[model samples]
Target: MLKGGCRLNGKKRCLLPLLLAGVLFSCTVTFSAAKKIPTILVCPKTLDNSFWGNVRAGAMTAGKEYGASVIWKGPTVETDIAGQLAIMEDFVNKRVDAIALAATDVKALYAPVKKALNAKIPVVSFDSGLDPDPTLCLIATDNYKGAFEAGEALARLIGQKGKIACIPLISGASTSILREKGFNAAIARYPGIRLVAVQYSESDVAKGMAVAENILTANPDLDGIFAANEPGAMGAAQAVKARGLSGKVKLVAFDASPMEIEMLQNGTIQALIVQNPYNMGYLAVKTCIEALNGKKVPKRIDTGVAVVTMDNFYEPKIQQLLYPAGNSGK
Candidate 1:
């Protein structure tokens, strides 16, 4: 009764029994595939800032939803490209299913990223993208556009004709460089606006405050300031408030930190260009799943951005998108 030599239930199996056995085997394979859980390694640039924290939240949400084992790790402070690379190397050695990274140094990450690729590991770049790599996919905000929006908002707040200073976190960071370029381009559209000075804060709030104090001391008449990130913005706001020039100097900053939002609500900061960090994280996880499943995905996906001010701060989508779940909606 058996098609081959094997017998089922102590007797030679007929063609019908063989077909039923094949069906059962196929069902077993399907069940095994469905029960398999994917493991993901998420490495943000740093957890010091709320931006990366939001990214971690999104990744965790995805992990929970998709039955994935997610390991979220990063540096305590940014600018530690070496530390990030070392972590990535360890993750690769562990043979994770995939890696999602927010690269601190675009060029410095080349070696480690390539190392992961050579080991047949998929890497997805989120938040901050690395230079074009054939083996990596990028999910991020369009930095240039976001910065341009901040510049336009600043120009409007300062009445188009004013002196503004740019306090960027890092001079060589690719995202910061693009944001500066966009900010400069936007200001170029308005002939009355002039960029007085561009200073590097090295991603330190105290350093940003010190630089802002020195700049304000030198140019007391300056009417506008554009801080490339949240720390610099908060530091500048503190400096302005300390000097009792809160309403006099218009502040337009990047990212919507709780402090920055409070400043906006309190009339200290005029506007902030907020990036969708949650979306960045969600998309990064989705992309990794797709890639691992042998599905095609884009090399770069823009998470888009928004400008947050006092007027629309309470909108539902804005609240959910910015604050996510479990975060104090402060």
Candidate 2:
């Protein structure tokens, strides 16, 4: 029915329809403008840990630097391959300008990555990757080398004459595989150091602790232990503390966590294999943006790693790697 001007039963002619039309037109213009600016999606292993938090921050910082809209999200934890794959598929369908992925599983993610590439989306793998393809551009720590250093550090700390064990993050994780290889290589050099046991933590803290406890029980004379990643390290540290083996166990671990830092201060772990996760995040986004802008980017970027012992813990460089953006809230 008709009313005053263009509305029915309204005192002031119900301008609602005209107002909505104006708003719709304005929204369309804004959206069209937004589409012109490139959109990048940065998907990490998870958002729960301090490691991934810094990754997220560095990625957003680069996004702001490059004037690109960045969407940072992933599974709740590192083990959720299906969740990560779904996000990739969604981004592919949306035709995102590019994607930076820290793959959940090495081989499982290869197909999804190829799918994104086929859909004309540039993909950059950071922190970890699918395969040994430098063409995809991997921004990550030199895991094998770093792990070898950790192994040597541990051997020296233990005087290379006792049984030791390794608690890896997971079996199929590329980082885990490389670190394991490097560790084996290092251990071979120390004949006096016997490899009594090796366990997989499935990237779970509790499992890491349980595995540590079991290994310690099975070999009470165990001299040293290496934890492959943050969670396993934390779990191993816990197990050592629980058994009152803190200083006696000669623990060496990878990555940095609040608990790990506390352990370092308290003498739970003799050394930490620290990686530059923040740089990995920043550079991944930067590379993706550059590619979108038609700039050629390198396919392999080692973000680098270092051994953080008490001797070098307070140094400026180690401080930056230990605490990126001066925030270690985890």
Candidate 3:
């Protein structure tokens, strides 16, 4: 007597239906074991911020739709270049099917990115990118243009003539560099505007606040400020609010984090240069999947940016930008 009430001692006496059922079960198990879902690794500069959280949401949404496993990982802080590189190397060693990276350091990421490419893994960059652009596709906002628009807006808020300062996220980062340049170029257009100081926040709120405080202390006559990223914006807004200069010192910052939006509403931040991080993450994953499927993807995809102010905050399009359905605009 065997498990299905079939005697195995004499094979010819066994029930044909039971034997066929057992064979079918074994075949089904084997087939199920053979199929494997593709895995995609999405690495942002840091994982602690709401901006990155929104990006993660978008990436995960795309992963679910495309039937690929999404692994979201990154350093706790944006300045941890070594940590990011290590994470990338480990994932490459694990042989993930694809990688979407918002690299912390432009030059340091090339080696691991190159290795992943050599191993036939597709790498897509988002938010920030590598120096030489080794990734198959770059899905991100046009940082330069966004910053330029922010500068123009800030200048307008200050009546186009006043002392200003800049708080950029990371000095050596590609996005930071481009943003700073664009901001300076825009400021250059208005000869009456004077850039009084510049500082690097490393995308840390406290650091941004400290720098903003110092800039304010050094130049009491400063009329406007531009903080290049979300954390920077929060810090600058706090500094301005604390100094009782909410309206006195005009502030235009980047990214529409909840805190930033609140500041904008309260007039602490006059305007926000909003980037579609959700789109960046979504497109990064989508592009990676396309590349893995042997389809050609564009070398670059601009997720686009928008400037938001109190005047048009309630508009339907701005509301959509601020609160994308699945994303809380974190």
Candidate 4:
């Protein structure tokens, strides 16, 4: 009988080293399978709105395509800067393989994003971005250009000469900041167009409507209105409808929500400056994976935009961009 390594048996002796080898092989296979899939944490600015839901869908799609795992979470509202920062810190603490973030406040989120980068986790920013460029990629629409187009569209609707109001979703949001500058720049191009009032909605739906109402009341002779985001557009549409000024005072807004689409269909909204949010979300995750794989990713990736109205909203080509989730025929 082999004292330590063998079982004394009448016939087939079992060796301890052979049994140990089999156990080691099984563990090696299990560990390798688990390590094959990289887990990512995606934190958008807000998940309550449909816009962010589309972003989440895109990220999830990318995750499936790349054989990666994703954990999607964010603040319930876009203005919750502290909450967003806390989420980022928590993801960092969890040691996620990568992170995709949409910053609620650029400067406020900078420190946490930087901390994740310093901790050697790759980060990507989509939609609104973080300052200091801690992200491997910044995937976003050309907000300034889109807003300028919206301004020009409004200017045309008002004969390029009238007192107009600018309603922005959030005063501190990076997208809002760019859109404001763009709208202002476009309005200045025409000597006749005057940007009279600028009121903030703080990214709240009700506040958007209330602010719009106040702007209209304060300027009874206002000719046109430009809403800089989905909520702003929605509120502005409601305000315009409630005042019975639908066709009289043109409303040009950014982003296309179901409500905004219905507004366009009914002539409450004249024009919509739309962005490829799905593309932004998908590319952001793709870039993060690239960075994690030791591949070079571009610092800036621009998702394109389009201006949609009732006249062109149903075009087959446009539907793909506006409804990437296979709603083209609907």
lDDT per residue (tens digit) for residues 181-243 in model 2? 999899889889999999998788898999999999999999999999988999899999999
- Candidate 4 lDDT, tens digit per residue, 1-330? 675556467233465567789999999999988786888988988887677878888888999999889899999888898899889898899899999988888789899888999999998888888656677888998889998898889888999899999998776788888899999989898899888899997777899999999999999999999999888888889999999999998999988777887898899999989888887778878888898899999988889889898778889877887777776535
Residues 79-149 of candidate 1 have per-residue lDDT tens digits of: 78889988988999999998898888778888888888888888888877766654557888899999999
TM-score, each model?
Answer: 0.88, 0.87, 0.90, 0.90
- Give the clashing residue pairs of candidate 4, or none: none
Per residue, candidate 3 scores C-alpha lDDT tens digits across 228-284 of 999998999999999999999999999988889889888899999988888888888
Cα displacement (Å) at residue 317, model 2: 1.6
Candidate 1: segments with Cα more than 4 A from true spot: 1-36, 326-330
Name the best candidate (by lDDT). Answer: 3
Minimum summed lDDT over a 10-residue window in model 2 is located at 3-12
Candidate 4 regions with alpha-carbon error over 4 angstroms? 1-31, 328-330
- Candidate 3 off by > 4 Å: 1-33, 326-330
How accurate locally is residue 102 in candidate 1, as Cα lDDT from 0 to 100? Answer: 84
